[model samples]
Target: MDLIIIAQAVGLFTVTNIDDIVVLALFFAQGAGERGTTAKIVAGQYLGFTAILAATLAATFGAGFLPEAVRAYFGLLPLLLGLRAAWKMWRGDDDDDAPGSNNGPALLTVATVTFANGGDNIGIYVPVFITVDHTGLAVYTAVFLLLVGVLCAVGRFLATRAPIARALSRWGHVLLPAVLIVLGIVILIEGGAFAL
Candidate 1:
């Protein structure tokens, strides 16, 4: 059980969420310079993550169960999402922050972006969630909920760090997309979604 808890935590919180640090940091940095914006970003993070989890659970265990054959292909979601991010970066569309500049997008807007960016998360979460027993599932859910706050706080702190934040906002476009594409490949292989 302990090992399962750790594995589940790593898989759900860290391994599958590398891209999130970038996105979350971006969200925080987007509002870090503005007063009261950090709270909004944190709230949006929780709200968006909850929605993603709810939807994944429903698809994994709902009336119409998710299929593994299809699950393997879920990897494509992240792989392509990464490519898209990279493309946007190449196109100079990435909203890079200069140390502490942020428009502080609306809380709702932040949530929407979070949800939208979670396409990869949903793809990986479904199979992982379904494989666990109820107890394990509960553990994963609880840990995820708790870690989310920590993740947000870390992101906010990083945003306040000018040098690091600038680098992340600048090079994140390269590193994050590469990581996501690799993650997608891993999920595809590990989930046996491409066994065919």
Candidate 2:
């Protein structure tokens, strides 16, 4: 259990940040305006996360999957996705739908964004699971879910403040993708795909 908690904490902490903020923005823009909406979104996020983690664990233990080269390739996924998002933002494309807008805050939307945003995390966890015990995977998943909910609540509270939210929204667009790129690079280096 302790191992699980540690893995969950590490994985959750690794991915929880501006990336999540962008995802949350999608939900908020979609009209998740009710007071209870954030909680529901968080719950939905966890469901998606758990599903991904389960799959990752299965692949790790059952198939001995995720070779180092494969991990490096997966590490680049976030870089590509983040760069695409940044390009869209730079091009002033606002046509992207918020999660709650079309589906009315359905669990599916939450799952979608969770899976999407969790792509890099999944890549990271592949290696983690290769080394860590299966129980650690569960702990990592639970802790990540708990922390994400808290972070979303806090972010919602902050975004409700007009000026701060606007400032965060502006900077978040620029910073989030940059951070993801850096994380991808780091992972690649760790996987020995990059020299420095």
Candidate 3:
């Protein structure tokens, strides 16, 4: 491992995922005190990041020709999810959709949000992925996954704190759906996914 290149990759990945720390914390807070909460959030993070790596690898390699329109359409996953959450909330049906509930955004919803959030990551990771050869990419991916675990641990720790956990517990329901909706719309517009 060239120390300098590894350092650069670490720096770039950390900078790109800075927001994820907060996002992950919020997710942890969502299921705070619930059994297996941390596990679910970590699983979702891994799932989402895997999708990102796949997309980056695909784009960096010969499979880089996906149309912008089609890419934007990817926003649909998160958008529909957010809408469903809002609908459930509005209908007072959120009991079944609560964080620990079967209908709530679980591993897959979190993965969608992570993937949708990672649209910009492709732009960043593609160049990095291309610049690095197979070996370097593999090493970077390994480090990235390890760092993701660390990130989730930190997020879970912070979420377990009394103050933050309470606030998130009170407001997470009101905020999560709205956040997902706006996040999806931003992804759509940013990616130029709209037909217009």
Candidate 4:
């Protein structure tokens, strides 16, 4: 049981590396001018991620089931989502015109961006839950949740700092698309599709 939990946690951690990069980019892009805003964005991201993890785990433990074929199909989801993020990054529309204009939109925008950016993680989680041992699923879920929360918090903290924030924000646009493209290629390879 412990081993299973550890394996699932490791898998979740592996899958989340790409997600962390994307979420960090999104927050950095949105909160370019105001470092304080990064906190809210990070909070919303973790909230959305928690919600998705709960839902996916529920489905996996409940009557829901995921076959190997479905898992393979889901493996492609990340690649597609990565492509979408790459496109969004290339378009340079990460800025929210109404971020500080109102609290509601600000929170919602953060949640929406986090959720949208997290699509790939959400997709892969279902399979991860299904394949792992039942007893370990809860622990795995908790570990993933905590990992994401910590990563987002650290990213927000780093982005809020003056020098780092400015430097990261300056190159965020270029970095975002490049990261997404590389993630997409890696996911494709993992999904048994050659990017070449």
Q: What's each prediction's TM-score?
A: 0.63, 0.56, 0.87, 0.56
lDDT of 4: 0.56
Per-residue lDDT of model 2, residues 1-196, tens digit only: 6965675576556554456665565454343345556666777777777766765776777665454455555447556655665676677665333221322244654665465455456566677667766566666666766776776676566666777556644565565456556655765666677743
Predicted structure with the largest TM-score when compared to the true one? 3
What TM-score, to 2 decimals, does candidate 3 have? 0.87
Backbone clash pairs for candidate 3 read none
Q: What would the per-residue lDDT of candidate 1 be over residues 15-83, giving only the tens digit for each residue? A: 755566766676555454568777777787888789877878887786454444655565675566666
Model number with the top lDDT: 3
Candidate 1 lDDT: 0.66
Query: How close to the true structure is residue 69 of candidate 2, measured as C-alpha lDDT?
Result: 58
Evaluated at residue 90, the lDDT of candidate 1 is: 67
How big is the positional error of residue 20 in model 2, measured in Å on the Cα after superposition?
Answer: 1.1
The deviation in Å at residue 157 for candidate 4 is 4.5
Those runs of model 4 whose alpha carbons end farther than 4 Å from true positions after fitting are: 25-38, 62-105, 157-163, 169-196
Q: How accurate is candidate 2 locally (lDDT)?
A: 0.58
The candidate with the higher TM-score, 1 or 2, is 1
Q: Per-residue alpha-carbon lDDT of model 4 for 70-91, expressed as tens digits?
A: 3334434334544554565556
